[model samples]
Target chain A: MSSRREILDLLRENARYTTEDIARQTDFSVEEVAAAIEDFEEAGIVRGYQAVVDWGAVETEDERVRATVELNVALDRETNYGDIADRIAKFPEVTSLRLVSGDYDFDLEVEGDSMREVSHFISDKIAPIPEITQTVTHYIMESYKEQGMEFGDRDDDDRLSVSP
Target chain B: MTFEPADRVDQVPPSGIRRFFELAEEMDDIISLGVGEPDFTAPWAAREAAIASLERGRTSYTANRGKRELRERIARFEADKHELPYDPDEEILVTAGASEGLDLAFRALMNPGDAIAVVQPSYVSYVPDAIFAGAAVVDVPTRSEDEFKLTRDVLESSGAAEADALVYCYPNNPTGATMTGDELAEVAAFCREHDLVVFADEIYADLTYEHEHTSIATLPGMRERTIVFNGFSKAFAMTGFRLGYAMGPPEAIEAMNRIHQYTMLSAPTTAQYAAIEALDSCWEEVQEMTSQYDRRRKYVLSRFEDMGIDCFEAAGAFYAFPKCPWDDADEFAEALLQEEGVAVVPGSAFGEGGSGHLRVSYATGLPDLKEAMSRMESFLE
Candidate 1:
């Protein structure tokens, strides 16, 4: 039986392990390893690959204030959630969007130092849209963990592997 | 293709809490005092109970409301501690945490456009959850001079008598203030007169240093109108276990349980078992931890005072909200974390009237607290 440990062992030994290498390590046939990899990918056990870059080379600001903007929009209006999301997506500062079940229709992630920068984006750029009715912003004070390493480091072996 | 996509769903904004947390994550060497969680591990009895439950093959889901014994223990605890008698079978429901309890209460009681009167500088969840429930929130700001206490005057001034619900948090979160028996009686009277349903969060009740926590439900005529929310997370140091309960009138309890059944069948079974043990054998441990927190609280208050920061001694909870010498708490917190490696949440994070203050959690060990205070002193200097 192909156990989870065997699969993880193969991946840990070589994150870029080919099907042949996996088969050699786990004593499975190349075709079987390839099929298993396909299954893992489909199950989202293998997420996308990332190229590690040295922070010294990036030259980007390391830290700034982060806030979530919850927006309420008019349903029948021309400037709908899609229109507003598209507009927000174009802004370099907007990081992500999540559709939540309650309160607001959409939650936007924005980055800046001063409230003025955030207010300017909300009042001048976002709120001016005809479909947008109201917005509430919650500034995050401190985070114990963030998206990348913390989420990726879950003990569960349910993540997908993606080839670079 | 069908007709063009809807305009509204795309127009919604993002979450502000998520953004601030990201900046907090980036700062290196920052000693965060901003987290809401208590630093202690789950009491040994509770932890052992959970382990035993898992070993005994009780990993599957419990009843939607919760394990019978756990609910019974909660009911007994409430009746004994606060004199709020509740029938476990009819008047208590388990939730993921007090957070979920608050959410379930709102969902069960509020309809769109209903008004929810919330005390300002309260837990971040109340107003947001009220908004999420499609209710307009009317904020009643309490003064620092009053130690941020929620008095009957504040409730009356907010015109919450006409509101569908009044939300209160005592042994409160950001500000560590609490209400006395007499104060709660006044609140109970106001709610009774106005026919307003009260959602009382007493999560930090067990941590009071100077005074005992008095539940509004304990007062005459208040049991029918008040829903008391308490949890193992704070008192038993079981933040990770995510167990809490609500006690209210049978009808309100039934409504909340319906939502709980649909959304979350129950709190984790292991957590329920653990919580049962917590109620049985965890009081002494809680008192010990509370003592430790009390010491840290005093130390932090004095340190802030020495640094020329104005602060009031918190009566309960493990936080110290100190007025920032700099007018902007967010900026001060950001600078402290970046320069001195000490992190505290900006007071504005809690809501209006919190602008110039910073919330410093004394939940860490004494050594860490000392180091953090020293760093804070240097930063202020």
Candidate 2:
């Protein structure tokens, strides 16, 4: 089996396993496992690896919340819009910025302490740009599917190929 | 709406300061003073508290504003330290950091075409943030002779009283400059007369060397209009922990908190718990650290003087903004980094009036600072 397939099978069974552990289990060298991981990363197939520390075990606090910012840009000021988007993208507070359609010109994912901080970005940072005319910010109260979790029991007998 | 091809988007210019820091990060064997991050870890007690919270399974979404205990502790801290009384329930808010607090203030208070006054050579975030809020930022330039302290004359001359809000940061970033009680009073008086909302960023207040940190809200009549931003990042070396708080009028706090509630939901729960312990158990450690910073500040100043590089004695914070011996601060900083493995941020990265100056943080240990000074001297020679 290709290294990619082997890694994927290991991850599918245990997404939280360390690279070294995965390599050992899959009978691959650590460097090979690392290379396979990098390939997965480059292909955008494997976005990231996170330690899924149980919220219950780590702390009984509420789960982390996510917020989205909808930005409205001017049609005539295309150059200015890109400039604005690029600038917004660079902010440490902003997680992602995507050019979108409908009433808004773009959608942004902002991570911060509270909605006030997010609205401040929308009002004080995002909306005030010469290119940005309007903005509507939505705070995510909860997430049913976050970081893309797949549901269902794994088929132990079937060999699955992982594409990079 | 389906748009015309010409109406797509544009990319903005890179933040000059951020760009410089990124470059500094790439170089091997670089002794960087480029970053504004605090050097020390979040106090061990604070970190331990956070870990304890994690062990206790306290990781859930907190109240939108923050945990009640954290807010209450912040209120107590402010009152005891600065004589600013705030109601934890209505007048105080916990934020990701002072950065977010400033952003929230601008969003809550500013409207398009409204003007805001900022002290020049201030933190880079103020200008961009004000601009983003649709407010025209009027820069009030402070001079080296004045120790870069914001004065009533400069504030009035800049037409800050006419602005929708006045954004002030003391024990300021980059410069390590602070305002005296009288100076703050004068500005407060002026703002009161002009009906200007005062957004005070006092993140570095606890790091003052010469005197105690005083809040504008401490002045009579000022508390009603002043919104103070402070956090644990600097004094407690909790930058990575990302905990801060804002205090202001009930109405204004409510507005900002509403936005915060809708957007952030709450600050990290574990961090908030840790912050409570930080405020409660960490004053002695803070004093010790501040004393050490003062010593470093003196050493760095003497080094600048020895090098014939004019620098004002910083009375607060851990940065020394020294006049560069060269004409262009950017070029000088680059040369220092490339030739001597020393990294300092160009003053221009902060704002206008910052050219020909460099901000060198003394957050590193005494030995490293001594070595950097030696490297700097050799490079200059």
Candidate 3:
């Protein structure tokens, strides 16, 4: 439903950009930007905007843990991977879910405050699903990159303060 | 200590903004939108090639013209991009930068009292370089109404019709104006009729947004008359490397190399290697940078509109020239810097043709541009 692909791309990069900013950066007017975004939300093309937070970088009372949980399921023709995916997605810890190719049937990325919490959720909530035959959890020790951006130290702009 | 400088040196003024640059340099936390170069670093491929060349100890001076490989690549590049063909061995001479190429062209082609028609609101160097080469400058100013493009009519009115040669730039530095193919054809026809040798500065060729850049050399009968200047500084983000080249008819290029051999000897050897790699692999990077510049150009133009500043659409380069809302652009720039801590080049720094305007560069990051705009908004209020 969103005809303005550039606006979507810009919003995907940084959702914090205002309608005026998006309009300025793209070929749309302010009203057009607002209306296109409205149309996207109405058509369910754009679900929501979220910040790309580096939670590990933040010092807080509760440090978080993350893991990729591979779910292998044997499905009857009527109940597809979508059914098992739907049940697994209901858990708040599952940050991302994808029906991927290769050895894995479904890939689920889960996050929780502690390793124990994440492990417990995988065993208690996900394993109980009848269609899910196997669950393999791999805990992530570090993130060097994320969302097409580097996570840790980045290169500084080393150009001179001014030049012709 | 009492030695006098040459007469040509006295004829030209020192750069207008050295004091302004010194002031900005001494300021604290000033957001600068005054730069005329790309913000991106040189592509990794180019940097790696330079490092590799140094590591290999390829430190010797190249042939007086330049490295054969680099010239071949430049010839192929021009043929592919601008549709102009030149013999690499005979027609191309790599120089320190486009600035050097400009100087070399001026010195090689112009004689004393010969008039060189120069388009104003241009780069800071053109007029002085012409004067240094002993050419009378005819300032042919392009107006905002014409999108700052040079047409045959403007040429006729400005008396450039009588000049011995023409110095022209497109995707112009301060104004960011560009001409269409048909528009360039008119200028080409004018140059052809006047028998003027064309020194076309196409350094901003890749930064064009609205349409594919059309080189003046590609027009009918222009190839023989046009001396094209291009470089890696703006396109490949290789300003520090100081690599640029000139392409033209064999006789003109040979004359340029004659001066180059006595003075520069050759461009940097490592930079030549870097330029080879840049031409070989950095085109995608150039395209990426161009797209980013286009987006920023749109953002700046839109912001100017919202702020009710009169700015012509910058169809090409990364800078935007907006008419100063205040009476004097220089005073406005100084006041803005002192009050809001934002630095922009006053338009008069370019030429009298650019007076009453401010050259706002969008070469900085978007966040800085946004912040600068907000500060400018406050200053205006």
Candidate 4:
């Protein structure tokens, strides 16, 4: 098995699995595991590790809300989808932006304190873009699962304390 | 209150780790590396099959020899994976678990005063089971110098070659050592020369990491003399289901079933149904789990190496037996558990030959293993 692939899979499953842990799991030296991860980072293959959070689970004065904004852009000959997508991706509110196929040219997930805030960001920031022609914003009602992790009850290890 | 228990029950002591288990039970947040079974659950398809069986009200006892369909699948599995062809109709007898199958084999083969040669530093059940069968256990200690493998010389030098029968387990428990086909062929030759009835406990056969497992029954002239015990407990992660089978000559299997019909009546119908599904469609899941275990095996060994502990390379099974730096592994394990909250089985718990070592299981998730290693390093320091 490929050591890099093994390390990648472990990190993908649980990012908290450290380099030392990866070394042990992969039979790679600590230095080798560190170097491989460094190579991955340097090559831009591993962009970043972000925690999958459930914002709704936390009680706060400013409850965070997320929405998916479908953008139908009419790109000029001079400005391609990359230029328009890049402009949309630069916004701090856009958690994920994809140049999707089908009816919408781009699917962007935006997060804010409220639905009105997200709507304003789309109208104020996204709608004013030169290539942007039409926008449809749908506020996310609830998130039961995200990034392959379920938001509800996680499976607990129910094995015995010890056994032969 | 003054009544005495039977000699057979009283003579054999309880499991060596009973005290350790009690101690661990009292402690809080202890990372245990002591379990001898796989951490994974049975595959979804298997569970579904059992549930489906229950829904269909097929909960009655199976045939004493087991459900024929399950036996047929076992036959195919044995033939495909180990190259040992068994007649599902005549040669396979399903029992509660490999533990029960082993006990049945011991009872069927050994008479009073019969000496059964057993490889030491082996599974905990073998010696006691031998005793229960009214047999004497002749210890055949596999040397650590040979990575705990039972070589022909080991058998010859020890009194095992002269014994009435021999019990062999590889991808060994506590040690995680295994033998190659050629190595097993050598032992097979020894068994042939001695006319020894061989009871092969290959419960961990599918979990071998380095090479494919070779059943002793596959070697020439050995099938008639060997009864191979295997189960879904380890390989298919069906420990709680309690499904296992013994494959051997018709007469031996019949002997085992004769006892089984009266004792267990049948392996649980639900487990039999589940095992059928497991053998039918769970090969891919089994392979996935085996790969996971292989990774953990490497990880545990690597940690021991970093700690400067002299651990033999465990080519199979999900354990690492590292030589303890302290004078007594039992003391070391106790102190480590009390102070650092990491639980590992002292090697002495396995047998006399397992003294001054520790069997660290890697069935836990990586995080706990890492925490335990760090705690062990501190304990060593």
Q: How high a TM-score does candidate 2 get?
A: 0.68
Model 1 / residue A55 / CA error / Å: 41
Give all candidates' CA lDDT scores: 0.77, 0.79, 0.89, 0.89
TM-score of each: 0.67, 0.68, 0.89, 0.88
Identify the leading candidate in terms of DockQ. Answer: 4
Predicted candidate 4 versus true structure: per-residue lDDT over A10-119, tens digit per residue? 88888887787777777677899889889989999899999988987887898898999999999777999888888999999999999999998999999998888898
The clash count of every prediction, one per candidate, is 32, 29, 0, 1
Listed in order, the DockQ scores are 0.01, 0.01, 0.50, 0.51
The docking category that best describes candidate 3 is medium
Per-residue CA lDDT of model 1 for B125-193, tens digit only, reads 888788778787888877788788877788878787778788978887788888889877887888888
Name the top TM-score candidate. Answer: 3
Error of 3 at B58 (Å): 4.9
What DockQ does candidate 1 score?
0.01
Against the native chain B, what TM-score does each candidate's chain B reach? 0.94, 0.95, 0.98, 0.98
Residue lDDT tens for model 3, B1-381: 788988989888877567668778788899989888888889999999999999999999999999999999999999999897889999999999999999998998889899999997899899999989988999998886787899888899999889989988898989999988999999999998989889999999988888889999999999989999999999899999999999999999999999999999999999999999999999999987887788788888887888899998888878899999997998998899888999988888887578889989899888899999989988998
Off by over 4 Å in 1: A1-164, B1-17
The runs of at least 3 residues in candidate 2 whose Cα sits more than 4 Å from the true structure, single-residue gaps closed, are A1-164, B1-13
Give model 3's DockQ, 2 decimals. 0.50
TM-score of 4: 0.88
**How many angstroms is residue B262 displaced in model 1 relative to the true structure, after the best TM-score fit?**
1.3
